[model samples]
Target: MAVLPVCQDCCQIVTVNKNGKIETHSPEPYGERACNASGLLTGRVRDIVVSSALRAHAVRRSRPTTSWGPVRVHKSGLLPRMPDAAPDAMPAPKWLPHLKGGTLASVTLPAAGWLGVWLPGYAKPTQAYRVEALTQRNVTSAWSARMECWTVNNQHFLSVANALMRRHEKILVGREYNPREKCTSSCKAARGPLCTCSCHAKHHGGGRWMAGWCVAEEFGTVVDGSRWHWMITGKA
Candidate 1:
């Protein structure tokens, strides 16, 4: 006996024999088992393809919707009708305190001032980061609890901490970019403005009391990782 499954998009039928092997067929033969699997995970071979398709679909669906149907423009610069909100009608971020001078300072930074050291085998850390606190200046206001420095609410303070560290030595840090296959080895993957990959070439790390409270990286690319905050906070 044979089982057939139809592709959801192409409407092409695939044949599966009793041994669970598949073959492509035209006009889908009868007297064979057919499964309606228009919306099912077929096999591991399709995981990546399916993920890419789903991502594209999400991007299409999330696009700005227009009140009117699509418009057609002519060489004369005329349109059938305005399709959506005028360019000026788009929303903007609400007013907030200037980041330059916010009282609370927190931002993820490098561990030991070194940023782009590739984990062995591109290994992902299974545990949280480990942060050690070393205090300088007045003991009365010294940072005692390491956890206090890493909370999301304390992003500003985290920035301050990183700035303080820059005064000491080169910091290891990675720049963030959507991962792409551009940089194979020497250069690491980095996010680009429009989904294209860019070379975030690592540079020498820097140390200094730079801009308000920002750690100056003298070198190394700044690739954003899923565990970036964990790496920065040293929270393990």
Candidate 2:
């Protein structure tokens, strides 16, 4: 079922469902009652107009809403529009320890300092041991080559040379787009895929339909998994 949100401007019922459908429903006769969708969790905005008191209770969706019968978006903010963490840089710590798989029950970082973790295949920790929690802060351990490196919310240290490890990595974190940070209003990105700052939102076009926040590589090359957030579009 779709989640319908109430609109304040024209007293319309709008909805942005989980199925990715955005539309507005019929409304009570104008001056008949009150229309106020004051606090609702909806998209940015959309303009709605009532064509006829008859169809006033009708429903519509997101198209070129610029022109529609007598219906009009008298108020601008009332338009029901549709749409919709970066970490440190450095090598794995050295003294983070090497657990081949001991009492690895939970997945939490062991120490809070700079540490290098070598589980087995990948340089990450979780992949190596059932338990995980390895971060990087050591600036003196020397940077390690990003060979067979795959980073996601968690770090798996499975061996790349092992078939199981490669397949497992692909299934676990084999995504093309990586998340870095949330795009705030102060962000400097125009809506669309042209964004090169590696910005992203909770939805597809972003919460702000007008502002874009994603920057892929320019050469259409695969980036280091850890840098996935910065990979948005192929360069010009």
Candidate 3:
């Protein structure tokens, strides 16, 4: 004899024999009535059957969609091999060099007033800055019609430089190369022993001078003082 699942509505036990016969036992007086009302005997178990079907359908729908068909397991492993690593999980290349000792610019200002400096050309000033820069620094640049130049706050020099670096990284996403090797078209054109291309300049210490020049133009040769002013101005 084999035991079937217990009735959900009532504590009823059902057993089936090899001779194609079924026997039901009710634990409570109302068990038989509850089973009958549920149409268990008449094979009209609508609620139970429909709920199971709906659950199966939901599970099927919830599975992630992919171009490939259903996965087949093999004795070795999965059919479509999993990647060793994901793109985002890879380590980011070092781009900017550490700051050295010096003030960014050569200028004098009142203890409270803001200093103005022209934006550097290599910084690739843009009308719309990246969201990272805007949210982190709240740094904004202005175009001076009289001077015909773009100017930013003296304190926002580093933030702007960082934003430019990020932008350049995004632009040259797939073109990443080993710094010691000539990888880009520009590097090949220059016929250099090492990567002397724009990508190299943007990522390596080669462009640090430009960054320092921009800083000097904006904040002057007073790194600690400029940083202190930035903190006091509520912009830090």
Candidate 4:
């Protein structure tokens, strides 16, 4: 590689080979120094540079892109993981009826022909039903149905939809109505934790808070003001 000396008066360039033989003589000299021989402008060096640039461009196009940031790749699990959110930050969900893991307050008929309803508390169900919560105080019998209560509590709050199947119905699905929130009370009912409401039945505007539904689109509970807790039916 060589940079020629320009004739300052006429701006003409002169090049010389390693043997001091005049290789190139220019009438119009370049304002800047010439590039490395066989590079930048033409030859195998130029082809290599162009090839590398094209490869980088193809890579950019091939990958999945997002405005939010880089794409995350991970092995999926059998059960979908939930979306993470901050505590107490209840921004109206992009989709609704917000969901969370809660305690099963009751499994009741409430009326004559209503499908059995499961009332889950926002607070994780505990054996300490007698904990002076000032709501279900009196006529004791805290936990009625011990229907497969998990000592390992369910998720607190979460979101979904990313990597969800394009079809709507397949993504958002539900299991049996029995969320089975923990219950440590000693109400031993022979029939799988199924019972009628008694103690906590008449708290607050209990009727207004009951808004649970069943798998068959059956309108489930109808009460509203049970002070314990209110969460979504059918965990996502």
lDDT of 3 by residue, 95-202 (tens): 211122111111112233232332111122332242224324555655444323344554544454444433221111011123344445454344211222325334
Q: What are the per-model C-alpha RMSD values against the true structure?
A: 21.1, 21.3, 26.7, 27.2
Per-prediction TM-score to the true structure, in the order listed:
0.17, 0.15, 0.19, 0.16
Worst 10 residues of 3 by lDDT: 227-236
**Which regions of candidate 2 deviate over 4 angstroms?**
1-142, 145-183, 186-204, 207-236
Clashing pairs for model 3 are 103-221, 104-215, 104-216, 105-216, 105-220
Model 1 has an lDDT value of: 0.26
lDDT of each: 0.26, 0.28, 0.28, 0.23
Off by over 4 Å in 3: 1-137, 147-149, 169-236
Q: Residue 120 in candidate 1 has what lDDT?
A: 9
lDDT of 2: 0.28
lDDT of 1 by residue, 1-236 (tens): 22334443234444334544333222123212122221224440121132454443321111222222222323322122221122322111111111222111123333322221111011122101212222223212222133222222222333434543332112223333333536454333322111112332321122121223333312223333322211121111
Better of 1 and 3 by TM-score: 3
Instruction: State how far residue 110 of model 4 sits from its true place (Å).
Output: 8.1
Better structure of 2 and 4 per TM-score: 4
Best model per TM-score: 3
Q: Model 4 over residues 1-236: C-alpha lDDT tens digits?
A: 22333322223333333553322221223212121120111111111122454443321111111122221212221111122122322222121112242122222222222222122221223323312231233422332233322111111101111111211111222112222433224322222212233322222243322223212122233223221212223312
